[model samples]
Target: MAFVPEEDTHRSSNSTYRAVGRADQEPLLGKQLTRLPPSLQRPEDRCHATYAIFFSLGIGGLLPWNFFVTAKEYWAFKLRNCSGPASRGYPEDSDILNYFESYLAIASTAPSVLCLVANFLLVNRVPVRVRVLASLIVTLSIFVVMSVLVKVDTSSWTRGFFTVTIICMAIVSGSATIFNSSIFGLTGSFPMRNAQALISGGAMGGTVSAVASLVDLAASSDVRDSALAFFLTAVVFLGLCMGLYLLLPRLEYARFYMRPVGPVRVFSGEEELPQDSPHSPLVASRPLGSHTPPLRPILKKTAGLGFCIAYLFFITALIFPAISTNIESLHKDSGSPWTTKFFVPLTTFLLFNFADLCGRQVTAWIQVPGPNSKVLPGLSLLRTGLVPLFILCNYQPRVHLTTVVFRSDVYPVLFTCLLGLSNGYLSTLALIYGPKIVPRELAEATGVVMSFYIYIGLMLGSACSALLEHLI
Candidate 1:
């Protein structure tokens, strides 16, 4: 029996420590991790491990997608102004055909970071207000940095020379950092009941993305340059950050998810929380029925276990869309109707977002957590739904693209949209489960869970894009 922490506050992390998820999980999934391995089995250690995962995910997310895509697009520019009339570069068609992966890779990692951080916050002992403020700050900072960087010149940009245009590059990296942290805080801190409210805000944020894309596209001409674009972006981000801080509670804290489920709150006048252990860097309290002093290593290993297969999947998949964007150049240059490679993704993103929202709404309604219901048994339910998609991949094309609508890809478009929605819902549901069942010390321990499916999607999405081009 896990005991609750009456203080209901979050722990802090100045240094990376080991804190993987606990082995014990709720029933219904039949997916409980057995007694945590010797490598990781302590509460405090688990939290620390999760921190490493979150930061790593952010780093991975920062690799540029447009960097690859624009290079592919410039294939034509090179051909047009070639040194010789007889031009030779990789197949123009091949490059354009597979450009989607680049964009996918670029976009995929950021979201993973966001989800990881938000979920981390969810499970942490930090006050919800603090978490929410952090989320707000991240969101605003991203917008500001992007807007500000629009004015910078990256004529000779390279990963090695990123610091040369540090302002622009910083915005890119910072966006991932802030986004991931905020989302982790939000997801980890907000309770089961509050998911939809948080999601509703996310849905609105998508609208902002749509608007930003439009504003950006409209402003770009023959030259893809904006003078105050970065400044404008920065201004918006800065203003929003201030506004966000104000909207959030001045002082608040969170209950540790790994400990036990309990109501939590905080007031304005506060500096720090009651220390979990006076000697420990972050104050930690043991739950109700545990009998053990903390072993630093034990805690760290436990946290690493949650994302076992998922983290690898994330890294591989994250680079997919960028790969797709590069492929797109091949198709676009050959006069494929889908010229810029933006239409499919923009369409996919739009459609996927709609589907994702629907899935989220469904999950929220299904797992609403009523008074009589202590836990939702739908973790397995969601997992089961995804099984067919992965298992039946070989037959997917036959079944999915049976009709002209699907072959013409209207059907695929519609189906993928639904798939996105369903996937999003499941992801949301899984995140909800990770926290609700864990004990306090491990509550905010965010592992590789969010990163797993997200990057896998990118990997698979890119693979599918490239495979289709290879096949067709």
Candidate 2:
């Protein structure tokens, strides 16, 4: 070989090593946004399409439940004679309607509680696609069955079968808990808006159901026709939810979440590993090449946030469907066969639903301060007082306040709106805030835990609403 200085040889070797390093880093550079601190990431990094998907998924999950609950007038009317002869119209069978309402309330929440509890075992352990696809299939199947049952002659299905239908519907609600957690967890890698979309979708579900109920009530001559309309609506929306979820994983943005392990960074189309919090799950010290962390540690970190999340839902469950249905109208004289203005499921319920949607959407503009903000938690606890306030709106013995305080139709509607606004705003904040306070890598697990807490609250609240039957 030609003579060459050792210095030159060493320089050449250094250049070769540098080239090798760059070549090796090329792939990881594209994959490395997780390494960057969140503040440094581009503001426009999030995929806006996911917001719509999350919202649709939310509506899909809750619409079926909302359909049954919102169409309370139709069911109460058709099934009034189940135990005996037809009990007349309007407020004639109020007692029986109240009893059935409580039963359905319990049935609605029981399965959600079960599913949320089981999520610890199912959420992280199951593959994302499997969990999502299975939940959608099961939910869609339930809607199909509901449509078929309602389409058949109401006489063929006895009260016992109606109970069975409630049980089946409850199971679908439970499946929704899983579906929600999965969707919420996936969005942890994106903007908080995506998570809020899921919640807002729930509000939208109620709104849509409310609107449909109004239409059915206006157009249908018979209660059976109303049932058919509601069930048909459910099937169509649920099918759409399924289709949207199937497309979720295929999105380039979703690739961040489809990883075998938790994502190290938020998705961004940039090169080089971004710097993140040193204590972040992505940057935290780990043994060897392991990216998966123990669930226990993640759970421990999120336990407090989970409790707050649970408490918020618990408050909502206690007041909503169960108590909201029991509030007495000031004047039962709308003359419409469907309902009075003050009726629990009428304008009052729809007001709450619409106001709730507005409250959740408000988060897109104004986020609750943070996990440490007492405002959200305080609002949740304050809702407990609404239970008694709403009870007072109805004609009840022992409480003279019932006649004095919420006597006007406007009072209950305003309170219901407030109740809904708080519910939507607080719960949405809890869900959105819970994962953020923890490591990004453990966000998926935190989401499951948060959901578990929410269902716990719902179950307890529904159960507690039963006491109101005795109290009022």
Candidate 3:
């Protein structure tokens, strides 16, 4: 048995950590704390290794998608004049080039909901190791394939290339969804900080990719080289994630929390496990075989927080990258690099990602409005106003909506930052609050369920983005 500090034992009562015995089993609060070998005692995080690893895994979860989307120059070059004869530059008239972001958004998000459902079903049936590692391997393999295609000229087979690229995006999205959900599910067994670390890491992943896009845009002349560099960086990062995941089990802190707790009654805060109780320090663990908890109770418990997460991401997806990327600078006629090439990436991708990172990181220090507060849902609803605000931006080539209400470049910049900051903070609060609201045994499943909410929102939002694009 692992030894938990006295303070930690007290904290366990309010958290999911408790005995994992059969529900019919009586409380063993009076049991004596069995002394364990020094080796088996709970260990420190040792310079926050466990936290760092979870954070890296978070980054790995979203890095591939970010890299894929942020390489706008590469995508434009490949899809340019694809249907017609080989051309030096992308023509403005090309349908694929004009709407590639929308197409890519649809392709990436369409399969995520299904994949998340599949992952939820497999939560009990499959080991976290197998689900996470296999998904990473699949995603890494896809990026490798994409890297190889970077140097290959597809002008003669442009449509085919587009088809293949979309297929690859769909496949990668599915794999990433599984990987992300599984890792997040695993974090349910750890402390709240670990979960926050994972969520913040995801924002960090976006920031890294955004910065990489800017770097490649400035440093590389050829679009192929820029894209190749992007995919290769993802490949290296995925490999590092694989190595870090393998290292996770070796840490004593992780091992202690991840240990299987048998069937125990749910912790309701009214009954405090005795401080000396042997099982009081154990965190929630995923039970094997047919012992998985029913999904209904878990859903019922987390319904509000789940909605907050889903709706938050839904609004985020509705405008970001799809509509946000299309909003051009007001100074496009200036012919300056800042107005021409860097405006969209800087204002949309880089700034948004950085602000998002800041938002998630703030959760590490402060979490307000609590999980059950109605204020959360109110915040989510307030974000809907941003949709129209974005739609009224300087979106070029507008047919149906001719007015640009926020004419200054500062409007998009300010709007994008606000969009990202709100998304990161609100979503992280909801995600971290989810498993805590459920029974100890149901924490992991609840985590997966919460993830389903997010992806389903993303899928619905992605579909709506396309419609909204047409409307604009």
Candidate 4:
């Protein structure tokens, strides 16, 4: 069945048909009707432009974080020899260089959760346009500043630089959270495919960063140059996202779906008044803030799906990048570039992200174990098995639990692929299904709530990852 706006559901059937009949008689109303596809007739995506834009926006959401984390060499270079000579490489004994990933995880995720809470409260208070655009601008500005700092040597000021870098990470992470949540909320009103597109784009963003890392690793000798190029690329993409978002409203397909759905009014012997018309019921029905559905009801409806979403990410974050990145290649003594420079990037970031993208893409074709199906949560729980699998891989510098059961490189590769594929497929399903299970009016808020679940999962997982890292 075609999607109908929530406002149309409030009206009696007879009045809706009568309004449609009367609207057919007026040229302006008829044109508006044609432009705004009928409730029964979905509009064409117009060369899939809207879909592509949403995908790109999805890419924009995660690209910054991906760029930041994947630039391991740059972080190492900057954090290296803070207490020693500048000519020395990253000190193996430096706590900052050693635990930087955990610190980054904490710095990024803590603010993200806080910002998401603020974002959820401000959903109806601030326009989505303001929130999304503002976040994008802030993120772009941070990347620009970061790009500039890449060339400015901070050898003498390593501690200061480290502190500033963490602070910047926190700010950018917060901004990205708002941008991602706002965009996810906006997609709730559109078809499910748009949401899928957004999630798939996020996976693609990781893959893009991984590829960029590999390229930079091969092509550039200097970590600073690679980092500068990386941050500059983010600047360009964020700028592109700003432009594409501005262009979104100009598309008929997006405009038709993105229109505000509110109570409709019937007029005698005239076309139905637009929602913004002076006499429209929406104008006097309630204050703007009152339109926000209470959070409890939405939470009640999607609690199961929310749990699945949160747990899926919790398990993912617990192992990925944190534990997975630390897993050394089994044949490190070979001195080959594959073992030295490319192993972690290839097996961990690139493979996982590519598999994750594949998993997300699979949902567009086949959505199994439907939203209400008990199988969904069951599958989520089964992913717990992946935790020990990753831990048992050849993670290095182990003081405790030093046994590596899976010493072969193939084990990490296979486990990582499974982690990415399952994470991508299951997480995408939970996200897309959350909004659909709620009333259309609450879809946006549900989207925000669902996002909150994801970040909460991330926050908890990031914390646990540190503990697990220490135990291993």
By TM-score, rank the candidates, best first.
Answer: 3, 4, 2, 1
Compared with the true structure, what per-residue lDDT tens digits does model 4 show for residues 298-343?
A: 6876799999999999999898778898899989999999998999
TM-score of 2: 0.80
RMSD of model 4, in Å? 8.8
* Candidate number with the higher lDDT (2 or 3): 3
lDDT for each of the candidates?
0.36, 0.65, 0.81, 0.81
Off by over 4 Å in 4: 1-41, 82-93, 263-292
The per-prediction CA RMSD against the true structure, in angstroms, equals 13.0, 12.0, 6.8, 8.8
Candidate 1 TM-score, C-alpha based: 0.49
In terms of lDDT, the poorest run of 10 residues in model 4 is: 26-35
Compared with the true structure, what per-residue lDDT tens digits does model 2 show for residues 1-472? 1122222221110010001133322210111213333443232224567668888988887787788787776676556654344344424354545566666778877887677656656554676667877887887788678777665555434455566667776777777777887777766655455677888998999998888877777777777778777888887887888789888777665554444544333222232233332222333333322333356555655565667777877777777777667665545666655446325556556788899999888876555444555555666667778766777666433343434465576777777888888878777867776665444565676677777777788778878877766565
**Distance from true position, residue 360, model 4, in Å?**
0.4
Clashes of each: 117, 8, 7, 0
With a 3 Å backbone cut-off (N, CA, C), the pairs that clash in candidate 2 are 34-265, 35-274, 35-275, 36-274, 36-275, 36-276, 37-275, 37-276
TM-score per model over all chains:
0.49, 0.80, 0.87, 0.86
